[model samples]
Target chain A: MSSLVALLHATRIELLRTLRDGSTLLMMGFPVLLYPAMIWGLTQAGLYIDEARDRETLVLGVADGVDTEGLGDDKVQIVPATLETLDAGDVDALLAGAGDGLELHYRAGSPRSRRTRRVVEDRIEARNTERVDAAAVEKGADAALLAPLEVDVDAIDDATPLVQFLIGLFACAFVPMSIIVSTYSPVVELFVAERERGSIETTLCAPIPRSRIVYARVLAAALLGSLAALGNLGALWITVLHGAVLVVEDPVSLPFPGPVVLGTILALVLSAALLVAVLMSVALSAARTHREGQTLANFVLLPLIVPSMAGMLAVISESSRDVLFVPIAHTGTLLYAAIRHELVATDLFVAVGLDLALAALVLGGWMATLGPTSLIEGIQRPAWLARLAGES
Target chain B: MIEVDALVKVYPGHPPVRAVDGVSFEARRGEVFGLLGANGAGKTTTLRMLVTLLSPDGGTARVNGHDVRTAPEAVRGSVGYLSVTTGLYERLTPREMLVSFGRMQQIADPVGRAEQLIARFGIGAFADQRCGRLSTGMKQKVSIARALVHDPPVLILDEPTVGLDVLVAQTFLEFVETAREEGRAVLYSTHIMSEVERLCDRVAIIHEGRIVAATSVAALVAEHGTVEKGFVATVNGA
Candidate 1:
């Protein structure tokens, strides 16, 4: 009961401390407002890709006396020019007409050149198939009799292009980014910064136990991080809407179902709590100064970012019990699935169980490491020098 | 009263260091006991052990009848500690810092207690200002107010006047006298001979992690002409 009171006071102080640091506030709040605009601009990128794929064919320079009737798309204009002049840069491709075949040439590495080559080749192939069909018709044979097999395909995928993109980008990329921006300074400020500035000694001298102090700081960080995450998602929502109007005409919105959204938020809370405990313990363990704490917190980003990036990119999109066992990646995958409306009972259950277990373990480790003596000797050197110093 | 017996602390390293080696002292009710030493002479370490910041490897300390090792919470609840290294949270206002400390000490009506200390310390002028923006003297005043808000019966101050201007330092010295008069046992550590002469009823001179002398200032002056010379003589005699 007494520990609870001490924790409340400590958490209140920690939260107020973070609110006052101008840099921390800016780092957390700006992304929410700016990212939406950036997301809305992605529509232009899609338009570019679509335009690139279906462009009108440029003039295909042909040798004189080459019969070019019905050879390619009607929009493609045939021109009379020597292969060298055309190939040099005047046309999309140069064609040397043979008796019944053609040789096509284009620039070696350009994407436009590759597109021209594919178009010309496809035109010739289509012509060849047409000739075969005409010959068969003249022989009084049905064209459908040419092949024995008949195949039909019925395809269904509920995810829209934008929805897929969001799900793919969410897990590894967005979650960890939110964690980093939201919790980094506060974690350092609460634990390592206190120790560095020598205020930790004063806090330790209080009648409250060190465990309560650790609890208060961790909870405070988690609460702030959760707020940042919700803000990020909210910004992402508005941005996606902006992108819909600008990038896709009448793009369908894929909102997570009400329960699913709440569950994802709860998952974010758990993952953030786990991250805070781990980072604070690592920071307080390895750092003696705020600068050193910042460096250590950056190192923590390595593990958080890599797996989450993989998940968000759909490099590992398949959900399973095994995936749920992983820490940050699990949170990312579960959140992605929930957003895509593909989340299932087992995925959420496993995610909750796994994250809670990890949080407990990390928090327990932090509690074990916290003490007056450890703070007095928290770390002898910067984390970077520990290896070098150890060898010496 | 604060009682300490043969307290020891050995810091583990390439070659272990005995930071405080079997030190002992006592500060009785209504007395200001001074522990004087050079830097790294175990004065802070001994005080830290008493305040329950660092645990002793051997022996024990008791503040207000609470055993430091077994009943450290009670010891902390009973004693207020101040030191040069003890700092205020820079982002919090002086009032917030004091109220937070009061709450930690589980004071009823913590805000009211903080208000009283704020007025007593003349902190009302800038009590709402964040500590980081405060002048050094103002910060010192806040730190003092924070320590006193809990109204603990014992005070352990380690160089609490290290950076204060002479005038503010004098104000703090007067407060110490007031605390002593209220029958609060004060264990004060410093190397400043003048403050020690004015405040301490008894003096313990520590050298190289061990106590070399423990006596009243008058007896030391009778033997060595002054507490400053007595400190030099005691440290050198060891």
Candidate 2:
């Protein structure tokens, strides 16, 4: 009971410290706000370009002998002009006279014009195919035999492109989140700074068990991590909702479904747990200096980020199931898959189980190494050099 | 009371290093025992063993008759330790930290105890201030309050007054004296000769992971002319 109290006290202190640290707050909250804006802005810009390109009018100047009727519709306008009128740049003036906008020039039998003429040529091919089918029908051959096999392409579900995009966006956010966990200074500083300031020694000397001290530290880190995760979730949800409002007219409304919401919350908890375990292990194993410990703790984040990146790219490619099982990859996959309405129960269980297992292994390692002797003596230089050869 | 018998700690390497080489000592109730050594002299290692932070490679250590190796909780429950580096949560106010630590120690009326300690330390002015924003002296007071939160019977302070101003160090020594008067067994470790002379009832001079000499500070000072010279002669084998 006393030990439990000590652990809680220790954890509370740690959490308070992290919350008050301005740099930590900035490091965690900045990216959460910034990343969504960047993603939404870039996506909006891309959509604008696509819209513009869709409305762009292509002007074509046909050779003198080509039929103007084949051009079809107002999608591409065609005008006939004499070589003398075109060569003198008079076609530009002529189009202005006609108020038809810009004019593209073509010469008789020119290969450059021939390549440009391919766009109109596709209609000719369709007409030729119709003629060929007619001829085959007259010969009593099956018209179906003349046609190639048809492929029916269906989307996995009714998930809108916007939902798919959000999934991808969420996956990208995980990279920053993972980086936030690994690089956050307070996590490392909690132990390393205390050791440097001589406070760790004071606590060690106190009538408190080492395990209690460790538990307190871990609990504190976990609490801070959860807070950070919550902040991120709120920022992300708001950004996503705003982006959806802008791009998805009459967006398909789903009350953040219970399972998906539950899964996300669980993922956040497990992520925080894993992060705390890693942070504790690094903090415990590091030397007394805060800088050294910070560097070491930051190193562990590299692997976590790789999985997130791979997951992001894999989502774009709709890659295989193997990608979904890799640490941070699983979080992104589950989140996106849930958004897309394609997540399976078995897959969710697998992802949660894997993350829990990883957290356990890391926490177990930290717990095993929480003895006072290991923590204090583990970082110290050897002692024999202090002795004069014959002094002992 | 604390008893450390043949406590040894070895780190494996190309050639193993013995951090604490068969160190043994005893501190009776209400006594202030000083462990003296230069840098890397095994003073910290020995103190750590007594605190149940490090496991001894050989022999055993007990606090209040509870074995540190087997019954660490009992030892932890009875001992208050302060290392050279003050481990404090810099974000918490001294009062909050003390109260929290008291609660952790399962002390009754922790908040009330925290207020009392704050008033006793004359740190009430800064009681509500974050520890990180406090000066070094204030931080040390917070650490001391945290150590005493549970009001344990044994106090193990490893270079507690290190890096403090003379005035702060003097006040800390007075605090140690008061702890002793309250019947707590205090183990103080340092390389500072004057502190051992002024504060300790008995002194153990350690060298190269072993205690080279052990005696009352007054007797050693009288015999060797000064505590500094006595420490040097004992540690240097002169």
Candidate 3:
């Protein structure tokens, strides 16, 4: 009971000290503002590019043997010129007859030239459809017979299912990344900063067991990291919803995730936060300063990012049960499955259980190393060096 | 009260180096026992063993009647330790640092104890200011207060006044004097000759991680003309 009290007080103190630093506040609040601003900037840039494409009048030069009777639009102007003139930049693209078929040519390097090629290709396609329909009607046949196959897909509520799936895929990678980033500074403050400022000795001398102190630090870091993750996800969700509305037609709405999917994501993100906190504590155990610890903490990103990136890129099959048992990667795969409405109870149970067990094992191993040699001998050589010297 | 018997610490190297070689001593209540040595004489190592911060490779140490190896938690609970290496949480105010450590030590009324310590240590002027923004003297005062938060019966201070200005150092000496007056066993470690002459009731001259002499300050002065001369003579194997 006394140990529990000590743990609680230590956790509270760790949080109080960490939250008092202005840099902690800045790191926690940065994701909230950054996600929304990034989404807005990207959306604006895309809109500007599309508007510029629509407003430009692209000149298409017609070769001498090409038919130019019916291809012109508000954005494309047809003019008679030789191929040499097109090469000289007098026109954005060229249209010529090649072996009974019409060929279009444009400079690959210029954005305007590429845009003109697309415009002219679309116009030519429309003219071919018109000619085919006219010939069919003249032969007393149905024009619709030219194309017979069709597929009918319904939108989930006001948003298409594909849009919802894409959003889910994006969140699968982003939420875990935010959680890992948020835990970095706090873990450094708790482990490295405490050692740097020399308070760790006082803490080690406290009557509480060493494991209890470590547990408290990890708990505080996990709680703070989870809170930051929530802030980032909320801001990201809002931005994605607004972006979806703008990109889609009128009356379109993003489909809100159901309770099960939301719950799975929350559980996975929280577990990831705890796991990250434990990994960081162990990684920074021998670090003597905050800067050194932060650099070391960056190595934790490898295990987290590699598997998640693999899941995102489909480099690893998410449907494989083996992937569901891998740490960090499992969270991403399960999150993708959950969002796609393919998550199963067995997968979640296995993934979360594996992650929590790994965290517990790592914490226990770290706690075993928290003896006087590591705690009081901070001035002496680090433990690894001591071990290399054949000293314990 | 603190009792140590043949405490040993060996660091492995090309051949083993004995940092503390079978050292023995006893410090009773209402007296300041000084362990005088130059740097690397294992003064800090001996004090750490007494406070249960480091385990002895051989022999035993007991603080407030609790053995360091067997009952380390009880030993830790009974001693208040201060050292040059001990640091305050810079982001925390003095009062918060005190109260937080008190609570971690499982004190029944941490806030009340913190309030009493603040008043007793004259920390009221900047009790709420962060330790990082405070001057060196102010931070030392807060550190002293933090060490005494649990009010243990034994105080183990290892070179606690290494960086203080003269006035602050004087104030710290007075605090140690007060601790002795209050019947606490004070184990003070330093190499400063004046501090040893003024504050120590009995001084131990440790050289090469072994005690060369343990006697009263007055007796040492009676024999060698001055504590500094006595320290040099004892250290030089004369």
DockQ of every candidate: 0.62, 0.44, 0.61
How many steric overlaps are in each model, in order?
5, 13, 0
Q: What is the lDDT of residue A19 in candidate 1?
A: 79
lDDT of 1 at A271: 65
lDDT of 2: 0.66
Question: Where does the lowest 10-residue lDDT sum fall in candidate 2 chain A?
Answer: A148-157
Expressed as tens digits, the lDDT of each residue in A1-392 for candidate 1 is 45666677788887999878887787778778777657645655655653564443333422212233345544233454332343353433222222122222221112233233343345433343354344434444455543211111112234265655554455346755676657776777777778778887778877777667767777787777777777777677566655544423344566555875776656755565556555655555666676766666666766676766655544354543355666666666666666666677776777677766777776676556664345333655544565432322
Better of 2 and 3 by DockQ: 3
Winning candidate number (lDDT): 3
Candidate 2 lDDT over residue span A1-392, tens digit each: 55565566677767777778777777667757785887689667756654443333333342122233344435233544332233344434433433222222222222122222332233223443354345444544455544411112222233355654674467444633544473455566566667566556555655566656665665566666656665565566556655554444344454464776656655644564555455555444544565555555555666556776777777767772777577667666666666566777777777777776776676566457554334433354334321211112
Deviating ranges (above 4 Å) for candidate 1: A1-6, A40-161, A164-168, A251-260, A315-322, A369-392
> Which sections of candidate 3 miss by over 4 Å?
A24-29, A50-54, A57-157, A160-163, A251-263, A314-322, A339-342, A369-392
Chain A TM-score for each candidate, in the given order?
0.64, 0.61, 0.68
Residues B1-238, model 2: lDDT tens digits: 8898888999788799998898889998999999999999899888888887777899899999899989877887788888766567677788888887776667789999998888888889999998878988888888788888888899999998888999988889999999999999999998888888888999888889988888998899899998999998887782
Residue-by-residue lDDT tens digits, candidate 1, B1-238: 8888998998887698998988988899999999999999999889988888778999888889999999988998998889998899999999988888888888888899999999998999999999999998898889888888888899999999998899889989999999999999999999999999999999998888998899998899889999999999899889
Residues B1-238 of candidate 3: C-alpha lDDT, one tens digit per residue: 7898999998878798899998999999999999999899988889888887778999898899999999988988888899988888888999999988888777889999999999998999999999999998999899889888989899999999999999999999999999999999999999998998999999888888998899999999999999999999999883
Candidate numbers sorted by lDDT from highest down: 3, 1, 2
Error at B15, model 2, angstroms? 3.8
Best by TM-score: 3
